[model samples]
Target: MSGQKACCHGPGYGTPLDAMKNGPREKLLYTVTVQPNLDEPHGDYLATVDVDPESPTYCQVIHRTFTNRTGDELHHSGWNACSSCYYIDDNAKQIPKRDKLILPSINSDFIYILDVITDPRKPTICKIIDGDVLKNHDVTAPHTTHCLADGNIMISTLGDAKGNAKGDFILFDTKNFDCVGTWTKGERKALCGYDFWYQPYFDVMVSTEWGAPRMFRRGFREEDLDDMTQYGCRLNFYKWSTHTLYQTIDLGTEGTAPLEVRFMHDPKRPEGYVGACMYSNIYYFKKKPDSDDFEAKKVIDIPAKLISVNGEKPKALNGMISDILLSLDDKYLYVNNWLHGDVRQYDITHPENPRLTGQVFLGGAICSDLKNVEVLEDKELKARPEPRYVKGRRLEAGPQMMQLSLDGKRLYISSSLYSPWDKQFYPKMIEKGGHIVQIDVDVVNGGMRLNEDFLVDFGKEPYGPTIPHEMRYPGGDCTSDIWLANDGK
Candidate 1:
């Protein structure tokens, strides 16, 4: 595939080298962004871009490889480490042994093992796991995936085959790519499954859940909240070594739809964070100094700022913090407000007291209709886009599927939050597809600036519109790196 702004279809994939390796060099190679066809049965794919500004095709999607299957709602992805506690290869190829991105399907029990090494330009789906095998354990709908110390692919399941909310985990052996036994314990099952992050330093792992398969399979409804089975509000902690269920911290009602879990970068640190969508909260969690137990408290709350009229409420108040990314240095936190149409950067020097340093609004449902401006820290930012159907009300979309750079200076942004919600909230995304926008971070001061020149508009593709999701670089991402305390030996 030539370095054209347009996406190459049907094996137009070129050589898979880190386009950044040329000219002024950077640590990462190309950026692999996930793009799923949200409408009908067109399938999903990964769009590889030359993020290196020095490259001739900077910001252009150089390659694309599709899954060939559709309606799967391809979601999050991560590399399968050879060892549980070993560091990932610095300049190694994204293939088996070195690393293969294990991607899970949200609607079906299918997991794709992608081989980026065989052909960087056209990554091959080297292997696929039938999640139907998990049906024996009543497991289906796999969500978040992480590598264990022994290199097995650990996954969180959202529900059973019958669509019953039974949050648990399933595993796949890295050697054979076979589905293993369950990862969660029977005594401490969750209400539903969403996202998780593990810390080898503290020997602790934490997981969060959203609604059951039924509720999330479709756009959210106000009436669904009344049913206790539809949502979750707790954080589950597990012992990293044993996979034993540790203490579970209940956030009560305010913690509805707890998702996107993140831990501080340093192994020495015992704390991390979780983002709650329905209630619009980010909770900081830490291991108790007195014991191995864990505790989480809400550190930031995003209020409902998008009212359609002066006195009436908007269609949705889910200041849904759908995607979140922490800086490599652990000094800053960046989160997206999908329903509110904004992305915020916060300084977290003091984990308990984060200072909001910057914010940028893209588009939102209610706010776009009102077109109002908000003044924060002497800088006036519109809470909702005014005249242009500003806030995103007309577009009904905002930033989502966030990915931060190795240096944390460039935060890649996507607009697709969820399969069912993208259409209802961001209707045009179905016909026009999604987008990829980069936000330049003033790391020293905790501020943000949108990169006007960089835009990977999926809607503009020749194959119709495609919804972009979670993304990763060939190397150096918070999710891909794991520090093993004993692996130093």
Candidate 2:
């Protein structure tokens, strides 16, 4: 199989040669950008590009390859492009040929599965698992799909009304991509949105519901908006085998619209913690070994003073927490504030009580007065004074996804909001282009800092203003799954 050639179907997967030669390597990190244009024919958010360790440039197509446990080549295939426009090149030139070959029409509620060849040189898509084909099917919106440690696949579905089905979790046979079992959220009122992060090592999986159960109650006329108090983000926990909901933590009342939750563990610390970011605050949870559940420990409220360049406070930094990397020693936790325009590092040496030791401002503080371009427009407006200038370093655009090397030496960051669904709202916010930034991080005097000299720009590619959603390495799948591939022995 190693010597066999493969064809392309979606984005290919590649492993670092160093990891293969060493032993169990670090888990490859992947960030997925959902590109959905509501004005487009099909309004479903679809995966556009991928970022990984192999490329200096952040953008890459879905079709690619990855080596199996036996080191054999495997192909990845993708299906269902809602709005079928190919990504544009950096020069604004469209890849007309590739666009013509691939279908451009967006398929409503259609889910696409990707299978890539292991060999990089001849990678191709081997199969495409369609959502409609699954039993008790509903309208398809590709939510989150991840490969479990035991070689099984877990996919969350965004229920579609046309399909007359509610959102549920579907288990699949990884080798054959066959649907084996299904876990339904039942006829619950809440709308289960896309993507879930699985921690196979801990035998725990976490998922988020964009709108709380109360929202569904209102939609069903069971409750009125004035009576709806439980309508924000929800963090659900399930046991690995039965997918049973063992515990749930409701982020407070101020409409914290939690999007993504991340768990971080340090070999040095006996207790670990999970971090969740919503529309409001960034919450941290600590896992207790004695009990099967985790406890909500701390919440970092986003200061309302942080302003955007437009002179208005951002509605909400709605997107997955995007990327969270624990330092090699697990002493510091680095997190990218997707829409808040900052990368924050927390001192988690004491997992039970994590503290914010340091932070770097990027893309402008979410509360800066300079963001108010509207106020700036009024030459006669003197009531609201402009913010004083500060010179450190700022990310030109919001970083949607990020990747860190196993050794914790290199950091890759990609820009591009998943419009409408994530943030920015497509077509209307198309003025903003996408870019990838590479940074070098250094640990000094017990603190981590971004090395300014190592920035790399991925804006020269021809993939038409890319919006990088995720970044990974070797053979791992999503951001939460990143780990030592083989245990760098």
Candidate 1 weakest ten by summed lDDT: 8-17
RMSD of each: 7.8, 11.8
| Candidate 1 per-residue lDDT over residues 133-227, each given as its tens digit | 77777988788877764547888888877877878888888787887788875476777777887876677888898877877787778677776
Which runs in model 2 stand beyond 4 Å of their true positions? 1-118, 121-123, 134-136, 160-167, 184-204, 212-232, 265-276, 287-289, 306-323, 327-329, 364-371, 374-396, 421-429, 444-463, 477-489
Model 2 quality (TM-score): 0.63
- Local lDDT at 471 for model 2: 51
For model 2, what is the alpha-carbon lDDT of residue 127? 48
Point out where model 1 deviates above 4 Å: 1-42, 82-96, 309-316, 367-383, 386-396, 486-489
User: What C-alpha lDDT, on a 0 to 100 scale, does residue 288 get in candidate 2?
Assistant: 74
Clashes of 1: 15
- TM of each candidate vs. truth: 0.85, 0.63
